[model samples]
Target: MSQEITAAQRQHPTRVASKPSSYRPEVQGLRALAVLMVVTYHIWFGRVSGGVDIFLLISAFLLTLSFIRKVEAGRPLALGRYWMHLFKRLLPAVVVVLLAVLAATALFVPRSRWSDILAQTWSSLLYFQNWVLAANSVDYYATDQSVASPLQHFWSLSVQGQVFILWPLLFALAAVIARATRVRFRRIVLLVFGVVFVLSLTFSIHETYTNQAHAYFDTRTRLWEFAFGTLLALAIPYLKLPRPLRIAAGWVGLAAMLSGGFILDVQGQFPGYVALWPLVAAALVIVAGQTGSPIGADRVLTWKPLIRLGDMSYALYLWHWPILVIYLIWRGREEVGLVGGSAIIALSLVLAYLTTKFVERPLRSMAWVDAKKRRSGVVIAVCVALVAVPVAGWQQGLQVQKERAEAEAVQNNPGARVLLDGYEDQSSPESPTLPLLSSLGSEWGTLDGDCSSYDDGPTDPVLAERCVGTDSQDYEKTLLVLGDSHSQQWLGAIQPMAESNEYRVFALMLGACPFGEPNSERRPECNDFNEAALRYAHELKPDAVVAVGTAAHPTEAQDNVVAGLPEAAVDLAGFGIPVVAIRDNPRFGVNMIQCAEANGDRGDDCAFPLSDKLSDSSEMAAIFDSLQGLALVDMTDLICPDGWCSPVVGNVFVYLDDNHLTKSFTASMSGEFDRRFHDAVHW
Candidate 1:
């Protein structure tokens, strides 16, 4: 989009053939507008702007025009040379940003975010950031695990990378067909893209509705936008808008792009039918064809200020998100207001200009690397290697830090003391050690990689090794624990009970899924997984089914909390299995370990009101009371103890992240858990 790039992505001779496509300042202006929309939405609204969708279209539209022209001209397509040029041009600026993020992460962001940042960095470099993000998008909890990483914005860039690589192949195939079949090259290419646009758009609409959180980052789902652009490109050579219509369309399109964020619920509705708002708008502006009328939006879009900004748009887009994120982390704000957003925008602009001028332009235009295909390829390889080596070192450093933290993990483990010695006064340090305490959420009771966690789900995989029994061959009563990660977190506490009593532990846990009503949450495969678990339970008919019975939907801390019981328990009771339901824990909605690191041991500073964390989820208990064999186990007191639930209690941290309990802390509650189990179920 930034023509400062000499990637030769668009063919040289083709640009002449594809006149009017030669220099579309209006398109560049659209690019500028898109970047601004993204930055503004991210900063003030914490929502996706749909502006990125516009860029995706424009990028594909231009590339398709040039490639089709080349294919029609009976050229070699210069696949090797074109790819080599892109490698040299696109990656240098990206690498600089990756390096900058790494540095900023170490300096400003908490150690909690380091690993995720590193993962995103590598993912971005490999151009599969969207997949990585999609994998992590839906987890055991109701909310995202961490603050949006500095590199998360790179997902769109990854999609662009896919387009850049794959779009040419489509054209190359079209070229082959055109030569062999005596069909018009343009018509063949158009036919192929039209087919792709329909198929991809259909799949996208389905995926977005069924699994929207992930659909936002799914490359498969995004292909429609890119393919749609190709279709437009194929049509553009024939498009000739009248001056009056062009003038009207240019204004209409600009108005839509500018007003999209304000008028739409992008987060809930985007990456689906709603995405057409921006994509279609950009398409109209592009097809409107730089009208020379005073009323034309191009007259505004081609303004010098916009053209210059558009030149920096790529760099600006790359730099703005991280800058905004780091700035918010530095200021300790969950969301920013006008002034913070302005400051972030100011700094981002300054950095964007600097990076474009110094890093992107100079590196993208390097004459030495541009001379030969082999040389350019070597430069690209070297640049990637440079980033990878340090990232590898940094990831290893985090591993070493985790080992040290685990070495100290034993001291933090107060076996059985939570119930016996209970609530020992302890002062939390100003901050927990970096990487270790910050990384504890990942360090839960190891299922030895066999047990499926959030990563394996919303696709459920059944495993048995992590399922412990007094003796698998001989157990009087089989205990099946069911639910998601919150359900899995209690494994340590429940394992002790399994050992003491003669019961085999069968964990039918799916991350973020608890068998309940209608599968309204609609996490992917959740309903299927829950149904399968119910069938598995009926087949096994475990002596007792234990589950974390309440759903704590994410909300503000001050909101009246309502923890509803999943209907799985009632169904289990119907199956004649006495159900043990543990009350869900308090949710702080921020990473507890990270909060402790920042705020120290001040319970008041770190803790929210117990009332805010728990409501009369007791209604669930009453519902179960009517069921013949269902028992409600309320341990809210164990978690929140006082009126305020402390993040760290009795020298052990409580919540692992926002809601789930620490494995060590849960283990420490063995006696209380045991006592409560006997009182509630009387097994």
Candidate 2:
């Protein structure tokens, strides 16, 4: 987190920045620059910098040196005590920032996100936010801006924390191997790190390609950077390059590190082979050491302002992201202008300094904290307690909100059958806010059984295995619903219709995969699942087949499409079963649940325009035109009426997340849906 210490820093053992006696002010300066780059990319560019990679290398590099010194000198590893020392040094600033985020959430962020913020707060405090984010990445439904968990940046810290604890154990093992084999301890350590570097690099390259979103936060995928740092540390003593070459290497390394935001596509190319550029540059700079040449980049790194910034880099990094998040929420916008961004940075630096001065320094300097295990335990307990307060409050609040929502859903929400007798004038709660506006996330209809949602099965909609009968006791006829979650949402509404019509509701649904050609699929598994759903639809030989008729994209005026469709609908019609394709609902990247909370009384202010929001279902409506038994249930008018789509309708939130309707909203729509549906099939 900090730069290498000059003799001056060693005197201040409680200093926030980590210090090794082999002081390199330039490296500290590099740390400052790296943090600045990260902050810049986050605010102005929405890009990632090689700066984090640089920090990752430096942390491991410093730790490796400290461990090697202890091993060679035959000093006690004091593993537990050293670990306590790191915890004391690293945790205070984190706890302070997390508390600040909680405060901001209470003030600025919507209650709709309280659960997520609370969860992420706990994850960040416990140092495992990365895994949480990785799991959310594969969940197609988790995609949206409102779900931007404040503690997301802690993923790097989580990775660093894992390595901090693990790397020492590695050195301990290396010491044992050296003692037993009569080998040089340094050589044993080098061998261990070399194996790690190779294994992790291989995994990183493969996983990055296979699942980049999850891989981005995977600690295993990032291990090579740390291992490479260890290797660099082991090699530094033996690197006997001349002064001129070392100076040249230092400049080249600095430039490469700076090039990350400009030259690299951080998302697509990072934590893989592309990471070698910044990581190797870091190694070069470390090996380069402080050059004697006046022109060396080292001179710039050691500048007083840069060194001071490095001294507070850890705090700066923690505070910047959350501050930016709060600012965005306050402004109710995604990106900020230059002035607003500058204001954010200025405020971040001030807050970072305060955190370093009051929180980190006070706890780290406590005489008992690092000196006694009992006090370290107490300090750790206190930090946990500090975090628990807000997390517990938020969870309790969410539970209360859920309870209130259920109560409201029962009382205020009119049954569609009775309401359809008159013009649609669904009643709204006197003041429907987050608790009611976003109540539907939990209220959304869900179905998952062997036939409805299974890991292994033939998913062809006609097959009995892929199909589940929702109400088999009333099964006078069959109502088969097929396709992805969009189609699945309809189950709540259609279940009633199916029951009333003396039909059993059967659904064969995949998460994001639609019934389409394998080539048009988003993932290979999706393609396979699509084939299964298609086949099951054919096998079930149902009286009716329900599916979403459109595919979507993010581009403006460009969402409508049958780009993902190929042979499913026309071929299904050949079975003489009516294919009821519901027009795909418009999608939004904004978190309407949160948006409604921020906009106050007229939640309609958050409404999305039809031009930008709508996705095309007309493609299938036309393609299925001449195919008998293939009915296009154009419900476009229902989803986005008159070129505008609002999140709330009749006081009920439509989307549970971004695209799919909530179970309650869909359930209420049964009357209208049943009417259109019957008319479409001419039943």
Candidate 3:
């Protein structure tokens, strides 16, 4: 990639196209409004600005009209000419902004985030950012206080680019279809526009209600905002509002848009029926045209200061987000002091002005005229190379980093591979291994309960006899272990214990089980896992049953699981096999080995204080209290002693990932089992 860039740079000369003097200030003013909305919303409230929504409408209107005009002049909509125009207009500013951000990200973004920036940069340059982000399934409201990427805003720009790519084809198709049908060009365009608008609107509303996150990134769902503007262009010749009415409509529209953008949160229905407010407002404002004077509409929107800001709006928008994000990164917090934030905003404005004046204006004003064909193409190629080079380098860097991480894990802790390849007994008894002292301890003993069942072996008489002798000899002890990946993790720890103890461990487990009663928690998966486990456990009629689960960051609903379980498990308790509740261990933020590699330190040197790692999940405590008469084990003391938790103890590495302990770490905790069992059970 780097070599390709070098070759391209050597072969091409960069050039820029001059914008015609007839270019309107109102457009810049609109740009200013869009930038202002995006910046303010991001810094203060973290939301999508109606400003961008306005821009989308304006872009649709302006570009469609331009294309239609060219087509009417009897010229084919030349793809190369259209693309060259777009490249010259958008790329220079975007390239400059992206380079600045790329540098800033390297200096400030954590290695964890570098890969994301690298991916986004490539996606942004290619105008596929929305799809890339959607594929990653990034939670727009995730609470991680990482610095925001400057290029994060490019998703909208990419959406626009994607629209343009197809819009021309659609426009040409509509023309051809209209010409063949003997219908007017304008009517056909309006008809197509209306159809697209309805589809987009319907999709937006449905997705917003069902899955707003998905709706936000969906291009098809967002098409109506642009189609609305296209429809306006078609209607422009037919509908003319009186000046007073047009002005009134403009102000009312602006107000509605502002209200919706400011008042709406990410949680609310977005880009749906609610989005119509801003889209309609933008349509009205444009329809009012420059002639309509809706009282103070001109004064409010066309003010010199606003116009100046609008002129630099493109540059300002380009610069603001990265600055704010870098500031957040440096400060190690999302909150910027009011004064500091204001200063940053002011700096962004000044930078925007300088960029607009010195960079944008100069470059855009230089007419390549006759040089437009080859020289302009060369410049576009160079810009593409620039974007592609860094992006390729970044992707390669991630691959290297992953390799390094794995190598580090193995080098520093030889058994890391063994830990990750979790063990399960399919044919025979499995060996025990300790989990990390951190969260997800290795305590999964079978609880003999009423619901325990027999496991019949295959047709193999020998294996069937072994199963009957060992597992079904006495259907007196039934046990269940249900939970997240954490619960599945305890299989190695308890399989041996269950066999020796003569109990059938009924594994009613699923990944991410929220150990609770049916219907009490809203998590459907958790409810289902418990429902099946509980039903099966109820049927076994063993002496007593035990249930174990992950207590990692236990929520209120999880607490309900513990509270609700005692009554449900009363049948097993009645048989004298007391219900045993196991308390989970603390969790480290990142995998112990991975964190060590990134920190350039060893696990021994980097272990956090026990208090920091150990979380007292209220849910687990409630469960313990709920089953007071039953045996309960609080494993915190075993995992952390004397206010200290070691990532590596007794020469064993701890966590296999951010949360779950390594098998070796869990194996070491087997001693705790003996101590707890001697006191709790009479085997």
| Top-scoring candidate (lDDT) | 2
TM-score of the candidate numbered 1?
Answer: 0.84
| Candidate maximizing TM-score | 2
Off by over 4 Å in 1: 1-21, 141-146, 415-435, 443-477, 496-503, 510-532, 549-576, 588-591, 602-604, 607-627, 631-644, 670-683
Give a tens-digit lDDT track for model 2, residues 474-554.
357676677677877777778778767777666765677665555643777777776666676676677877777666544
Tens-digit per-residue lDDT, 102-183, candidate 3: 8887776655456567767888888898876554443322212244566777877888889988788788777777667756
TM-score computed on alpha carbons, candidate 2: 0.85
Q: What does candidate 1's lDDT look like per residue over 1-683, in tens digits?
A: 11211223343546544455347888899999999999998998877788999989988888986785565444568888898888788888888888998888889987667777787899999899988878777654422455678888899999999889998888878766655675656677888888888888888899999889899899888888998888887777677877898788888988998888788887777688888998888888988877788878898899999999999999899988989888878888789888888988998899889988987788677888778888988989988998999999988887876676556644443433643554452323432432255466464542332223222221224434224233344556767777677778887788777677755666766676764543565655666666767777777777877777666644543322113234566677678877787767777667777787688744467787777655554565676577555677777776777566777765677776776787777877776888898799875
Would you give me the overall lDDT of model 1?
0.74
CA RMSD, predictions in order = 5.9, 6.3, 11.6
Q: Estimate each model's TM-score.
A: 0.84, 0.85, 0.69
Candidate 2 vs candidate 3: the TM-score winner is 2
Residue 462 CA displacement from its true place in model 2, Å: 18
Whichever of 1 and 3 has more TM-score, that candidate is: 1
